[model samples]
Target: MEQIWDNNDWLESANHWVTKQLKLQKINSIGRLKPVSGWGLGHVLKQPTEQGDVYFKATAKLPLFSNEALLSRYLHSINMPTPEVLAIEETHQYQLTKDFGGGLAEDSSATLWADAFEQFAQLQLDSLSYLKDFNKQGCLNRPISDVAAQLQLLIEHPQLQSLLDSEIILATEKAIAKLSHNIDELSQLEIGETLVHGDLHIENVAMSDDQCIFFDWSDACISHPFIDGTYLYRMPDSQDKTQIIDAYLKPWKQHYQPQQVEQAWQLCEHVCYAHQAISYASMMLHLSPEARVELNTAFQNALSASLRSNRQTVKSTTCVRSKFCGMVSGILHTLSLIQIKAGEAL
Candidate 1:
């Protein structure tokens, strides 16, 4: 964690790596050292240009480095939104990416990210055939099970275990079970080969005017067709979410099985929930006092959301008769409608 070499020194070291991958000039003084997160080896630099603006990213030995680059190339070829990897290669102690920009960050608006979501959906249809070749659906999803194991580890961390009381842990476990059940449901859906973005999320998606760019191909692999909607399915609002999914599925289903598409949403949501839990643990295990409070607050919000959703799902499965009962029932039913709108099953 000590400074990964001085920023400028790191820049030069990175440029040599880039030169091996593609032709690019080394410029003096980075336009700005953008603060970014995830996999910590990467950094962004902007260089002002007469024609337009150019951005660069430097990394130290990315795991599966070439595979990520190849996937990025494939994605770009399909006209999906993604940073152009002008070049990439290894240097003395690091790897480098030239002009890598795009992908959302820690602080971004989910409401206004519709365009990004749409682009991702479009790309899913285009890329599904090839996605499965990169990673198998069953194995990529084992991480979902890992999430439960991670949560169980926290039984020793009193600060975290305290959150499990008051139906939180029980509810969490139930949802996870449903997730596993749904994952099995997907395997049985009879859907054919397709590529999937194993870890699509708001932060992994980015927007630029009418274009939406997806980055971070670390988890890019082959999966069941519908597994890509993991982020949009968990997002807020039924009305917009429905319109959004219809925008992607209604027409496309004529080509692929609608049920398969639907099953993808179900599997994606649970896997995504598991992924979030893992991400939370990764952040909290060594967070500062302030960061710890924020992490706990976030986990609580997700917990509350999950509980409210299950209650509504149960109410939707029951009968409704009276006006007052109907009213509460309608509200819960509305919340339960999230899965339906996002293209998941009841």
Candidate 2:
């Protein structure tokens, strides 16, 4: 099936609208729009102007992604360092923004990482006041208490179950009871729900004027802020990782004791992966079967990680030595375990 951007009529319409919008900004387009990247979910086009290059992104018409344009604007209005939205067509899930320079580089220094973490931590801290705005913008609202039901739904999802072994399915079903306990314990700590960059990573952050500018709000949601730490725990450098983690936790320290912050962070390890599984599974529901196949491995791996992390947490009350456990690399090792147990059932 052709993607929405592949339709000539739609492309022409977008181009015309962009040209008119640029004229309103008194910026002249120096060239035609160039396709940057595209997929079933959305497409990005680059348009060069006399002032600078601006980007146009259009997302699939699903509630999950439709809030990106408006949400991004709202974030900027609330003093978050997001890219400037040149124009937005919320009805169509289309947005245009001036380029914010290149994203955080692969070889960024530990200092930059620490700085980014500190800034983003404060961003999440400040986002609490605007929960109503975020909800009004249709952001996904996945509170911790609701995650158990999300897991139960995934256990009953026929399409997801079809791709899984009986043992894997049973493991997910078994994970719910223990996971629910962890969720309740963590909720008692009152860490507070805030904005979560559901797909956060260094690449999604742009460094502008030495400031960490976060963009790409397609997967933005409201949830426990620490769940946003999914990538920080996976960083390759232990020393730098510690620094980054400290910088992030420093902001939260003002609201809770060090013990509470540490405990919630540990508990969030498993819950974060569960959230990832639910997110991927939810996206799959909106995709075509062909597109859904593209995400099957990711969905399965996230689910597998969630269950594995929960069991690991159960085995030891203390924090696990390897923070990387149940992350991408750990998922590879667990895949082998899954194959070995595939024939067995609960």
Candidate 3:
């Protein structure tokens, strides 16, 4: 069988990206770029120069770069639980980042772990206090068109045909467009906006010895606090997820409405998997069968759960009922901080 990975190109691309994006010369073989399992675009490179541990992630085609950058800047400015954004360059097809990594996600004490999440949750809540306005700073992206393109690509590609459903597929396109229009309507209601870590899944976060610092600012943005909470809902472990939320919401549930928080979780339930589905399909197109089957199954389950949960999100304000009934199972929660690299879209 033909191997899908190009051993030579991975390292070559990393070096080129570092040179162009960081403008740092003298980056030696250091090590090779290893693609992070499950994620299609994130490439982790081991650097020999910086103690055989420091790594670089070159992410291209991330969806929410500007928003992520803005949010990371906001968090960093306020002293939040995010990674230091080393460098970023927003060209056409991708954005490159040099992340300051120290330890793995599983290596942290309970007190320290809680503190990290608490710090991050506090940062998000603080930002939400008087948050309002979007950065007319650069080109405004069209979410509908962008998501539609992804769906279209999958439909057109033979390799990813398994996941497509004609009726559901078409409905998803219209739903994405509707969501875009709803986003426009958000400002009309004078909804307060806070810095959001557009995509805050657990894998994107890493814990160092002294802190629980998070990386991946591609999804950073100024949006409803609910959106930020929803972003936090992606952690796979149920107990861990609650702990993260409780720590974040501890100091300030009074400042937020519970219903709104529920809304946020439901929204994330739908959109996060929406992202995963697209991501999974893209990976299936290029990955070996083993990788494809695992990701595809996960995507399928997520899509089903999201669809079931989002069904009740249509103006039912009592409690944010989601298909993933656990998030809103009457557990008040809180969160810590996130990071933003230059121009790397989430």
Best by lDDT: 2
Worst 10 residues of 1 by lDDT: 136-145
Compose the digit string of candidate 3's lDDT tens values, residues 151-247. 5556567655556566655566556654443334333333354555545544556665656677666545554544545434545656766776777
lDDT of each: 0.51, 0.81, 0.50
Expressed as tens digits, the lDDT of each residue in 1-346 for candidate 2 is 3345656788887888889999998999987888998776788899999988999998776545537888887777778888988898887678899998857875788788788888998889888888887888758787888888988997798977887889988888888898999899889989999999887777788987778899887878888998888777556658988998898899898878776787788788788888888878877887778778888898888887788778767654454334434354688878988977885743
TM-score of 2: 0.87
Clashes of 3: 19
> Residue 228 of model 3: what lDDT?
46
Model 1: which residue pairs collide? Answer: 55-99, 81-213, 128-195, 131-195, 131-222, 132-222, 135-222
